[model samples]
Target: MTELRHRGPAETDLQAADDFRGLDKDGAPDGDAHSDSEAKGDTGLPDVPVPPDDTPQVLNKALSGLSSRWKNWWVRGILTLAMISFFFFIIYLGPMVLMMIVLCVQIKCFQEIITIGYSVYHSYHLPWFRTLSWYFLLCVNYFFYGETVTDYFFTLVQREEPLRILSKYHRFISFALYLTGFCMFVLSLVKKHYRLQFYMFGWTHVTLLIVVTQSHLIIHNLFEGMIWFIVPISCVICNDIMAYMFGFFFGRTPLIKLSPKKTWEGFVGGFFSTVVFGILLSYVMAGYRYFVCPVEFNSDSNSFTVDCQPSELFQLQEYPLPAVLQSLTGWATVHMYPFQIHSIALSAFASIVGPFGGFFASGFKRAFKIKDFANTIPGHGGIMDRFDCQYLMATFVNVYIASFIRGPNPSKVIQQLLALRLDQQLQIFNSLKAHLTERGLLPANEVAA
Candidate 1:
């Protein structure tokens, strides 16, 4: 009776379970299951776990025989030349293209930095972090570019009713948008991840400040003249190349602990090279009206124009040499554009202080234990790596122009007048007419009319 009970329903149910799992009562897979697992080679990772490098196959084949160090050098050198060629192409295309390139670079750089921040605190799985970061970027860009459009292309904005309204209330709208993002971030904070969320929030803001603000300044420099944009940028690039050349061969004494590869030899060589380069480049660019003239909008033609009388700075001038230089050169005076003198300051800063920006970036990478920001560029690391110094140089150039070069912009003043109500415009005109009349600058007939 006991044997019958054991062999009845209980034994049948156990057999059914084993059959469903494709295993016998001994808990071993059948022949089919074993063969399938074997065929799959279950290594617990994808076949190609990491993506292949996107380097050109021709270059890779050509460089396959070289040592790793030499290969890296050749790759970087070739790519640098390619980038310069592309840059020249864009410049030929026009300022609009250059501005577009700057905008694209700014977006890429922001992406790289924000990605690093995300990875750093990815363990917490913070919600709305990326969304909020991008939201803030859009808000900041809207505020800045809106101001630029309103200032430079006032006629275009004034003609479009919606744009005119938006231009009038741009700042308020930007603030409101930012406040919404801020509130979203505050609400997304979780109890356990409070510190991490705020850290990322601060991280996002700092990245925006560094990337967005400086790039806007670059556009501002571009509007002033192509020379202002080109000279400073070229100086930074030239200094970087010259310094690298000097350091690579003669880098015996280290310049800074943050970047051990940097050498004092490179620093000095780059400074003199950059200063000379700046002067020569500025001289050449100053002679060309297209390069020297401020970019302006034409309401009549509905296009941008760079046709203006050359400013005194762009004209040839003779200045007496200092006693020390006069004695050295045996000349009382030298002919040069005044803008060349300003180039000295621009180049000096690019070579001297611009490198510290790279060092700061180096320190940042070290803190995060990263070799480079990203692998976007095979030998150059990333766009941000190349531009770390350029942004700093842009800030310095903008400030230099503001402090010494720029005065009140008459076009901007006129634009402001045009944006005002007719009555307000008439009031300003009357006030100006009275003031000029008092100074005997206004004709009696014009004043009466």
Candidate 2:
């Protein structure tokens, strides 16, 4: 509650503002330059000073001044912490529940992405359309992640030995959820102002978003521990910060045509900085040597270990090794060059993809010809503006790791958790699941087995 309140006037419920069209105070046409107050009736209310449609770059030179770099870093810090904390909490909370919460955030974000353009390019009872479309997008987002969630549920059910009977019944279960959702999309067509474009395009984005984001989480969880799940999120936020820090402090070179306020100096600075920090983090975690053993490779036999205790188990003391080891594990080493190599690889991919997502959002704003996604944040723009990099980066990380390397799984985790009782051991599984839930890990409901 304190955290909610601390956000202040900048903290209007974006869900509430989803339908908002950002009208001016006189309640007149945004394009109309004149007002009735000038000619005749003057109300007691003071006129709200609307910023000009043609805003000059560096709207506040003082704000954007080198001295103001600290201010930019400050805002960046808050946003970075917010994104990190939110990602950390959500990833463990329970995948279905985290996704549902993401559904609402996505609605706000996707709506702002479209409406920033709407605000500048077109006009009507836009507030109504914006609001209606927001709920419509909410449904679309709900359907998108809901599809994943529902599919995941059936996938779980279908995996069971008993439920394997439903294997032939897969289509009956899987397709049904989306079919029902598609019908809901059809029902929304009653709002004549809404074109199928909104529903189709909107659903497309939400679906891609879930696939991309979920893959990122799964990949990170595979190799590194929970902290690496924030890799993409941290990179995106750091990109914003170091870019701001460099742009505000030493912004001499403009990078490209998309965002002129952004500088090359800032972009490179943030990119390398994030990689440095991320690799450092990876190295630090490596010190604890979380995984007890390495994936065994038999050089002489050219075969893999048959740890058929379960192929799922990552570690087995019984697995043989020659004096010349295949890989390193709990026997910790600084191993900076190799670890840094991995971090750089991951961060470089993210840095490029992250900014592309931002440019995508910026171009989106241009298509709408709007200034900011929405005035949800005073210095920042909208939730989408903030999360755009994160959205794209998550997808990128997922694809990258999936294409390159496979990470550890829970059976291996279970092997490690064996230090505890079978009952206590299962709590480790609970922790893994907490990643996808909403309650944000409520101490395991009294540590049930």
Per lDDT, the best of the predicted structures is 1
TM-score of 2: 0.52
RMSD of each: 14.2, 16.8
Tens digits of per-residue lDDT for model 2, 231-290: 555666766777777777788999876687888888888888888777766555444323
For model 1, the stretches where C-alpha displacement exceeds 4 angstroms are 1-54, 327-330, 440-449
TM-score for each model = 0.85, 0.52
Worst 10 residues of 2 by lDDT: 306-315
Off by over 4 Å in 2: 1-104, 114-228, 287-340, 407-449
Clashes of each: 0, 14
